[model samples]
Target: MANDPSVAHDPPPYGAEVFAFSHPAQTERLDSLGDLCDPATTADLARWDLPAGARCLEIGAGTGSLALWLADRCPDGEVTATDTDLRFLSRLRHPALRVLRHDVRTQGFPPGSFDLIVARSVLCHVPARTELPARMVSWLRPGGRLYIEDPSFFPAASSPDPVVRRLGDAVTTTLAASLGSDVAAWARSFPAPLGGLGLAELGMRVHCPTLTATNAAGRAWALSVADLLPAMTRAGALSEAGGTRALAHISRPGFVDIAHAMIAMWGVRPLTRHTEPRYAG
Candidate 1:
């Protein structure tokens, strides 16, 4: 069903040209992102009662950290890790894990193919963000859970620290301009639509971590900012001098601020056809 030629060919904002899988710093950036977010992700997943034989899907499984975790957690189960680029995922080895190069926008899975589905920091970059949840929900078996985590830069965007604010604004502005990224709105409003999607037992949480220069979040932010600097400067979202100053400020030991809030929303597909899903907002 995913290969249907009729599906719209909407490209992602984080395509190879903008954030290449071949970039030398990509591995490190992904690693830092995993270090920064995996704990919270795992904790949230642990809330569900996943069975040993569960069939799991991790969309946009960058670097395969969470996919490997699922493989370990569900040793007798099958885990499909998919990404548009597979270079990082190719390095992972696990008998229960299978890696595939897949695009969520243009491709899909058969209905009820998985028991659990998760995507972290992935959908926000997709132009078809609104349509993806239903597509993913269609892939889950009844009673299966869908968990999505995306970043809301509202905190950082309005930081009291001038450097942080400027950097955050520049990053969001450039991404919105060049890539059509939602930046904050989609993530902040994520929970509202799930109730209408035939899912039950909806829940939501937010993780706002403090970022210091040497911390994982800080490192990941710095890497991403560095990668986007050229485009940001070119778009006049950030000046050359401002970029330099912001980077310097972020690397200082005393520099501390709130990282973007990772908003996590989850819901379970109704076991019965007549079940009315309630919004947990």
Candidate 2:
């Protein structure tokens, strides 16, 4: 989660504009769901034991695209999509859909209220990630499921480009550095936390570190973020010198290969699950 006190981030710049996605021309990828994290998420659901009528709760429900997908999947079930922005609520319309402005960092739901919970690309932005697994369990009934994803970016010891090095250094050494930017390391703690939660039927998958991001659209998105570097530095989410340096490095020729790694984790509540260790015996 955002450990930096210095980085100030408002929500990741969402507006009324509808997002457009691009895909690569050729197919060399192992799993190409293409554009947005939803495809990766939906593929994972294919492996789970969720029947047709399972209820779902989605955190960080950006743009309502994923919620709509889940609603279509579990047509017989209800899908609750929650986010901090009310503007996003304007885009949703589904019979089994419900939207709310729920910020987990401030408050949470009662235990055993949801059958399935999903938070993609979200754990790192929370103020702290300590209570997450237990909270997932708290929101699940017995036999329920939880899914989470995050980046575990660490300072690279070596980078050919000076600019890349600066961005890497900030993310690794200072909490104030990644203030609103995603925390890369928090989600890698996954398998470890799965055991701690006493969750059974646990499994996980690690996706590529370099995404084709070569497609013109993905390239534009990267450039768009790069364009926002100045504002980010001013907002204190990144240092002026460091953010500019990262963009300069990423913009170089053939630099579009620069990609972030994605990790996925899943676990199920034991039907017979009982006592939780508040502390050691």
Candidate 3:
């Protein structure tokens, strides 16, 4: 349903004005995110030993890295990479991959559409975060897998370093205000509802990577801060000078702290008929 053209009028929080794919630094930012998180994602998926013809749906497929990986991994299968913005994805050409412009909140697929569904750093931005998991589960075939990952700033929120704390608060605050992101809440409650969705083999893991000024995680964080700086400043969550100072501090050699905890939750849809999931709104 997320590909429905009727909902084209609905604006996404990360719209062109917020974090456009056309921005000069957008590619680097997306790559950095992939660099920082893809290994763990792939590790999880690889563990499943999926069939060569597996059908995968990658929601919020930012730069298409994982989708491309899936295509290569499942050479005989289909991979649908969906995002609200398709500029970056449109550039990728692969026989097994289909790039689609989709808004997860509005568009959707028919029941039993995929063998695997995965999303990273996405549901946190959806206002209906609580309900989307059920909807996603409905799109999976029996014995299918669903994996969801999100970042939580709880550690950074309580950081001892003033600069880290300030910038972290600013970034999270700006995200919450501008994108309706409830990252912290979503992270904390991620695995709660999946059990009721007719899924089995539920599992979860939290990864908290170390952040240094020069590391991929650090660079990704800095780029994100840069992207959100304007909104942060405009909203009075962070001032221009303060943001600059924080950036400078983060770029120093000694800067070290825990980045957001990337929490990954997964479950397998049982191979039996079950009540259809209900969507909220």
Candidate 4:
């Protein structure tokens, strides 16, 4: 019988170093992210091709919205939605969906167990973020797909809009320095590891949408920046008055900001390799 990996360990308590995971507004932020990136995510899904009866796994399945969609699309298969904090994903109720309180850094899916693996805006906060993609890609069955979407905040930080760019750049620079995670570097060198690992058909796309208060995606972007005010202030990225002004500017009529670039990248495991026998039992 196939083992239930979810039972192998007790779900670790949710106090990880990841910024969003620790943020009080994480659920709202993740939901907003889903709304903001829905179209692009859908496009990537179409490009990668989600087949019916294809087993899927979504790491950092924040709020499980995208995971739920995957479950619906792969109705004949199973979708495992995993995160360290299950507060949001636990709410999803579907026969095809399996919710697991698992941390990607510490725990892992069985090798070659999944047909598709997806994660969005997740790698930035991870301590071993760079090493994770290789591990994740290994969990796929031969010819299976791995899709990752991470952000490059430099573009938004350098936006032509002065008011918006000032705040955006300050927060991004401060956060990256403090966390020691350079997103711009990652964006510039994405998918190279996949290629090195011998994965085939690598492809990537970068999207930077204009954010205005009128649209759901834009409002979400603004709210996400607003939510980081406290951290930005503590990090000396923005003064109290500057933060207040920036917050107000985003809400004002005709306010606009360019969102960080979302870089979507994917690769398929080669079909010629024989499935590893270690995980078959």
Highest TM-score scorer: 1
Give the alpha carbon lDDT tens digit for every residue of 1-281 in model 2: 49786885554322211121121311212012235355677888766666567889998776676788788878888999987665645567998898988877677888888888988766766555666778777889888988887655443324555554555445434432333434555666666666678777777776644423455334533554454455555555567676665655565567634344467788888788644522211
Ranking by lDDT: 1, 3, 4, 2
**For each candidate, how many residue pairs have backbone atoms clashing (under 3 Å)?**
1, 6, 5, 0
Clashing pairs in 3: 1-107, 1-108, 1-109, 2-107, 2-108
Q: Candidate 4: TM-score?
A: 0.85
5-52: candidate 3 lDDT, tens digit per residue: 777433346756666677789999999989999998898888887765
Q: Can you write out model 1's per-residue Cα lDDT over 10-96, one digit (the tens) per residue? A: 443485656677779988999999999999999988877886699999999999999999999999999999999888999899999
Candidate 4 C-alpha lDDT tens digits along 118-234: 888777656477889889988999989888888777776667878777876776765564565456667656656455666777788878877777676566665666666766777
On lDDT, the stronger of 3 and 4 is 3
Clashing pairs in 1: 2-108
Give model 3's TM-score versus the native structure: 0.91
Candidate 2 matches the true fold with a TM-score of: 0.72
Clashing pairs in 2: 4-175, 4-176, 151-184, 152-184, 152-185, 153-184
Each candidate: what lDDT? 0.87, 0.61, 0.86, 0.74
lDDT of 2 at 139: 88
Q: Which stretches of candidate 4 lie over 4 Å from their true place?
A: 1-25, 50-52, 273-281
What is the TM-score of each predicted model, taking all chains together? 0.93, 0.72, 0.91, 0.85
